[model samples]
Target: MGMEFVDLFNQWASSYDDTVAGKDPEYREVFEGYEEMLERLANLSKSPVMEFGVGTANLTRKMIEQNKVVLGVEPSSEMRRIAKVKCPEAAIYDGNFLEYPSLLTPIRSIISSFAFHHLTSDEKREALQKFREHLEDDGEVIFIDTLFKDEAHKQALIQDAEKQGFLNLARDLQEEYYPYLEDIKEIFVEEAFEVTFEQLNKYAWLIQARKGE
Candidate 1:
């Protein structure tokens, strides 16, 4: 609730979806891929899912209709509360990547959208390990976010966002991934997960990985 990064998102939670609905370029080709991937991963109607940083419950609601019992985790209480209203049918938890909620039972799939980038590099690695430790042997992860090619981009992002204020919160809070592809790969490779990156548009893309099933 008090985290600077979290607080910023919480403050924007109420209008998060509308603010991001169509602005992002990473969303392309993801819906079709995910629709098919859901069946390939597990029974969408039966598989349980945990959405990290499920702000405003935009995608959470969409996934739930496909039948995966979705549980969302967001660090911002303001975001979580707003998400709850948007996704009344799904369960949402207030927590950061460093911790998990007691309510989360067991999940076969963990999904994140534009959320993972908020973490520091160390936190990102730890979170990947955390997922490996907690996920079922065959679990998979789907992440979509804005990745930086190098430090220059990272700094530019912060500066750009600072000038824009809350409007640039998502871009402002980000982590670095040199050769972005490999860095993302490291996040899940050890867990027997494979990476696939799709640059939907400029500065954004989708990373889909699957664990050994």
Candidate 2:
């Protein structure tokens, strides 16, 4: 199932930046917030940073401007090609976060936007453990993605989408792997990571967590 998306995104990589933003005006607003969050994270740290699933290098470009030593882990070759064009100085690697070499030690911050859902709950926990190992003692992990409180909340979102005359979007939502909020919190707690969450919308949020002492 996940491999399917890799191929799909690879095919879409060429025109991804323009099409995704041009398809809807709302996406532009979401991307603005996404960029804002990345900029804030960049300002928070002067150390090395890593971005997981860096599609088209949207945030990578921002980190480059902040002068942070940035590395990007991207699964799709086509996407990495685009990311290179977008941020040539960034060290883009060909792998997912779970399989990343972890050669960069004491990484100050590891971040992902709208890409964490590619992992299942168990996979998410596994990836988080790997991220923790690669991070500095007080390093942070930030995720901005589709997040919901529970199944009921997800259903409510579907209903809201239908009310807005977006049945196709609702259908897509039903099949998506939006991470459950409490489940992610449990992983953070179990991993001894201090966590904070900021809601971006009814269906998306930004989560910032740090390894606890």
Candidate 3:
């Protein structure tokens, strides 16, 4: 699955930004909101920032524009190439979140958009633990992805997509796995990370978590 996704994103790397611009209104809105949040976070701190699975470095470009120090961890070479062109000033690492070492210790904040849902629930927990281990004293990790309460909610999304005549998209959604809301919350509790979940819609959410002092 990992290698397949790497190949898929690599294939889509060139057209990734354009494809994002042409997405349906709902998904576009989520990206727009994510951009706003990324900008705000960049403006709020001058500390080092890292983006996991930064395909094309869309948000990382925004941070670079604000004069923030940024690092991008991307497993796809093609995606990393585009991201380098887009955010040449930022550092780019070749790896995924779960396996990547702490390239920058005491990072101010870790951010990922639309990429984290690729991880399974256990992987998510492991990734979060890694985030905590690499964070600064007051650091946080922000995730923006498709987060659902359970399988029922995901099924509803698939049904709605099919009803709207997006059969292929619905099928893709069916194949993708999303972390359960309750399970994520429980993991946060067990990890002692103070987490806040902001639901953007039935399918999208923003998770902001900070390690306890």
Off by over 4 Å in 3: 1-3, 23-34, 37-46, 101-104
Candidate 2: which stretches are off by over 4 Å?
Answer: 1-4, 19-22, 25-32, 163-168
**lDDT for model 2:** 0.77
The per-model lDDT (C-alpha) reads 0.64, 0.77, 0.75
Give the alpha carbon lDDT tens digit for every residue of 62-99 in model 2.
87898888888999999998899878889999889578
TM-score of 3: 0.88
**If ranked by lDDT, best first, what sequence of candidates would result?**
2, 3, 1
Error of 1 at 179 (Å): 8.2
Residues 1-213 of candidate 1 have per-residue lDDT tens digits of 124576578667665554464444333312324333323323322367888887777677778767778877888888778778878988887787778676447667788766676666667777777777667777777776677656676567566656655343433344323235557677667656787777654456667776664
TM-scores for every candidate against the unseen true structure: 0.73, 0.88, 0.88
Extract clashing residue pairs from model 3. Answer: none
Q: Candidate 3 — worst ten consecutive residues by lDDT sum?
A: 22-31
Residue pairs of candidate 1 with colliding backbone atoms: none
Residue-level lDDT of model 3, residues 1-213, one tens digit each, is 144578888888877776566465534533555556656545654458888888888888887887778877899999999988877888988889777755735688888878887877777778878878888878887777776778788788778877877776687676765677888889887887898898874556878888786
Go through the candidates in order and give the clash count of each. Answer: 0, 0, 0
